[model samples]
Target: MYQVSNGIGFYVLATYFLAAIESKFLRAIPYEIELIPQEEYRSKFCYSVAECRASYPRAMDRGNDFFKYLLSRVVVSSVGGIPKYNVDEDTVIRYMWDVHQAAVDVGKSQLSDVSFYSSETERDFFMDFLLAVEFSVATLYRPYINSTAEFLVGFPHRPLTDQDRNVLASDVTVREKAFMSSVKFFSRTNEATGGLFLTVWKIAMTSEAGRAAGRFLIKRLLLIPSL
Candidate 1:
């Protein structure tokens, strides 16, 4: 019958459309992890205090010991005046999941808006979403030095030195400076993103460990400025 043929055609078209949408969604999600080798990691270190100071002059001058403490924990290497830190795979996955959830929340909120359905608007939104995801991931996992003194100084390598103790000391000045620098950096980042970064900061700050870390680095090692 004519009615049966029309129903079959509609169903086929609907199935194809769903498949296309699913493919697009999968491509939009960001889950790739690129690991750096030990040699490559060591190649990125600044090699000396002067190199670190030169790489992040302002942080050295203004960031204090807490900054150094954070630096010591994560510094895998220095790249172009910036200290790059290693992020664990689990941490990177958690960050990506958080970003993805935030995107979903935003998408859901705007679903009823006319602009949400517009092809041009949707395309722009998707592109921006992908970009934000990429920036977040890169910020978290940039390659760095894997020196024995920095990340693996004690356990797998030599014992901690006096210099290491000084660097890791829980000095009050360091903590205060770190807290202040974090506030300033996150404030600026949120302002730049028109409050987008604020949302992410809030979500991250909810965890006790995250809150402690934020109180320390404001968000993470990313708060440390280059030059």
Candidate 2:
């Protein structure tokens, strides 16, 4: 298990951790957010639950990349004129505040005790969750989609196929195998902890292939989703 740090380790862990968080966030608040004043809706909208659900495997990838960009800049500070990477306790909380909770310095910081980057999208984020709740309740109790199977036919964009159904039917076994296969990349017991192993590993991560593989492995493995 690698750790997230103010170093290359951060990149190594970001893809996996962010994917997990994004998946859970959509699951927890699975509703399409609304936008008022058509103008605002057309611009500056971060992510829609429907879109993310439709593209579940690679969901929120663009946002996640931008999140990395914004976060990297935010965490950098000039230490005697040289910029250095840093992520204070408060900053960490703010990044994942909606996704999780921590022993935050309450009162001193606002927006769910994490400061929310000073109401920078964090406000809209909570609003999205609430809106999602209302939408879900309305759809269910009002018998909204009971009329058509189309509502349940698809999750976001992709229509369900027989293969997807089969996967769900044997979810436990399929997931177990998928998880084992994906993480096999990191299960090298023979490799030393230092020297060449560490060097090559870092080099690999510097390339797109290395990072992409990591992202895929984690989405399929640690998360243990049937699909």
Candidate 3:
């Protein structure tokens, strides 16, 4: 039998939390990160976990992008002068890797179908997964912001024009805001429809129209049980 429960709310929360993390982190960066090697910039975040880890072991091993980003900031701050917007090659590389990893993690956790049947194991897995995701998202902010600043200030040479920087910052802000808003709604309820929620978020982040449509549908769906 299909269970219509509030389990869906939990998924919403987790999704928004994830998006919040992204938004906060991106805002922290003073400049936009150009995903070096266009081929590496697949899926916003890197999708191939194995390859991502292998290629950027340092970032993966750190387990917290914020911390790494922070450390980079501390280094720059210590240097005491804002040079051109030239970030070091390694620093940029690592940043790109972290961004990719975030994308991958989100993708993996994203729900494909809303009508999920709960086997005990799957339920437990989802719970654990959400918790892990939450921890990762919450703990890394301060460090990531600090490090991002360091990287941007100490960049080896200024690669981005003022216009480019502005554009990147704007783009990141929009993305982060949209992602977190959806996640906030997702987190407040409990249901086993994570997959469905993920689909909605994906659409919302894609465009203004998609976001309006997604939110409207969600509100309508939420009213069904009451009606």
TM-score of 2: 0.21
Clashes of 1: 5
Off by over 4 Å in 1: 1-73, 119-227
* Candidate 3 stretches greater than 4 Å from native: 1-191, 211-227
Q: Per-residue alpha-carbon lDDT of model 1 for 88-111, expressed as tens digits?
A: 554544443433343333333333
Q: Candidate 3 lDDT, tens digit per residue, 66-109?
A: 33454355343324464333355445544544554444444335
RMSD of 3: 20.0
User: In model 1, what lDDT does residue 198 have?
Assistant: 54
Against the hidden true structure, what lDDT does model 3 obtain? 0.37
Q: At residue 185, what lDDT does model 3 achieve?
A: 46
Q: Model 2 segments beyond 4 Å from truth?
A: 1-172, 189-198, 207-210, 213-227
Which lDDT tens digits does candidate 2 get at residues 3-97? 10111122223333444455452246455343232353232122343433343323235335434644455435677875555655434423433
Q: Global lDDT of each model?
A: 0.37, 0.34, 0.37
